[model samples]
Target: MRFSEEVCERLDNYVYRLIDPRNGETFYVGKGRNNRVFDHAAGVLDVADDDNQTLGSKLDRIRAIKSAGLEVLHIIHRHEIPDAAVFEVEAALIDAYPGLTNLQGGHASSDRGPMNHLELIDKYSLPQFPSNPEHRLVLININKLEDRFDRRAIYNLVRYCWRISKSRAEKAEYVLAVVRGVVVGAFKPENWMSATRENFPDIPYANGSELHRIGFTGIEAPGDIWNLYVGLRGKRVSDPRLKHSQNPVRFWNC
Candidate 1:
């Protein structure tokens, strides 16, 4: 079903076509806001974290199509239409593609229902932040990490530290130390070790300074260690500490 331009303006809805990459078969028909195409591309809706499995399942179907070499085509429509009209559009779209099946249990035929965020949380054992007061404050800011710390940056830091440490525990310890230092605003060589242990007591810190010592001597300036620190703190690239003049070379060399 297509949307009238008037309806499109009010509804902001669209039908996404997930076609098999190999044969251009329309494998899935679904509707969402027009701007959610990027989330579709990134498989954000497919994240199986219990909070969003319903949507995730739908997204996974699309991913399967892509994996089979299909291209996704989005037919932008409106989201503000009456439930009857929205279902009619979806039903018509599915009818146009005979092979597609309604995995959403044909719920579009019923009245639109509101979803509860807490219900999702209860159903899915989603990860929650530590209850500790100090960590709780940091949890509020965890989402900010996505903007500053892209997957590539985190991967590079993890891999580099792992290679140098020769052990996973050592690698985790090293990374967490840098993370703590960045969060607590302690960049001094003398204070870095104690600060890490104080913030993350759960992590063993027999000699917290060892990681810093190795990082200062072994890695190059603005390497994984520095990037990891910036990522954990979710600091922008333009932050003052990242400036060439204020870089952590002195701490490393110390």
Candidate 2:
């Protein structure tokens, strides 16, 4: 049947049909402008259109008819129907035709449940921390600080490391390196003990004083302190004299 613009313009208040020729089944039932019928017939509907399987089934029926050398027989329109009435009518019409029944819902179904922490981690593909010698050792040292050190000591160490590191960027690398060393056994424990004693020999280990003398502090509350230590240690390793000058008191603070 021919579709005219006039018929489509009047379709706003009606339900429309595109039927299959071979089995005489109702394939699609929808409420829209008449021009939409042509658009559907042309197979240009958006993804959401699949939500109405009756329409999809009808289109398939039409394809079967074409393959069997039959032409579309009719395009019917009934005007002045509310959207609710159109839906009811379409559902009833589809139910009436056994051949046109759609048992599965229109869209694809998913079996997934709410995501937990592990699922979230997997979905995002979070970085896998080093599992072998390097990272395992780092994790051990990270845990040790929790057990063996006070917050203040950690803070002082980190702060002192920062002071002598030369630059902020280098400080971060230095701290990370120290932590890594502790974890992987790269730096000997005895060496660390000696270095700590050499840097801070006095009592109360007052803030800024011991740090000024030895140029290294332990990690403290403000976790970023390690960054500074890392930088200074990196520099000191590269050039021993970087940490070799007599305490600042002899040079500037006297």
Best-fitting candidate, scored by TM-score: 2
Q: Compared with the true structure, what per-residue lDDT tens digits does model 2 show for residues 1-254? A: 43576765665655555666666656555555556565665545545644443355555666776788776554545665776576555444443434433422111111122334643444234232222211111111121133222434333333332223222222221232222122111211111212244455542344532332233333321333333223222111212222111121110110
Decoy 2 TM-score against native: 0.32
Task: Give the total clashing residue pairs for model 2.
Answer: 16
Worst 10 residues of 1 by lDDT: 135-144
Error of 1 at 60 (Å): 4.3
lDDT of 1 by residue, 1-254 (tens): 34466754666655566555556667666666534554654456544322452455556766776686755555443355565566567655665665453443223221122224642332233222122212101100111122223444332232221112222222222222222112211111211222233433543433354343222112222444444443333332222322222112211101
In candidate 2, stretches whose alpha carbon ends up further than 4 angstroms from where it belongs are 51-59, 101-254
Instruction: Report the error of model 2 at residue 35, Å.
Output: 1.9
The CA lDDT at 69 in model 1 is: 71
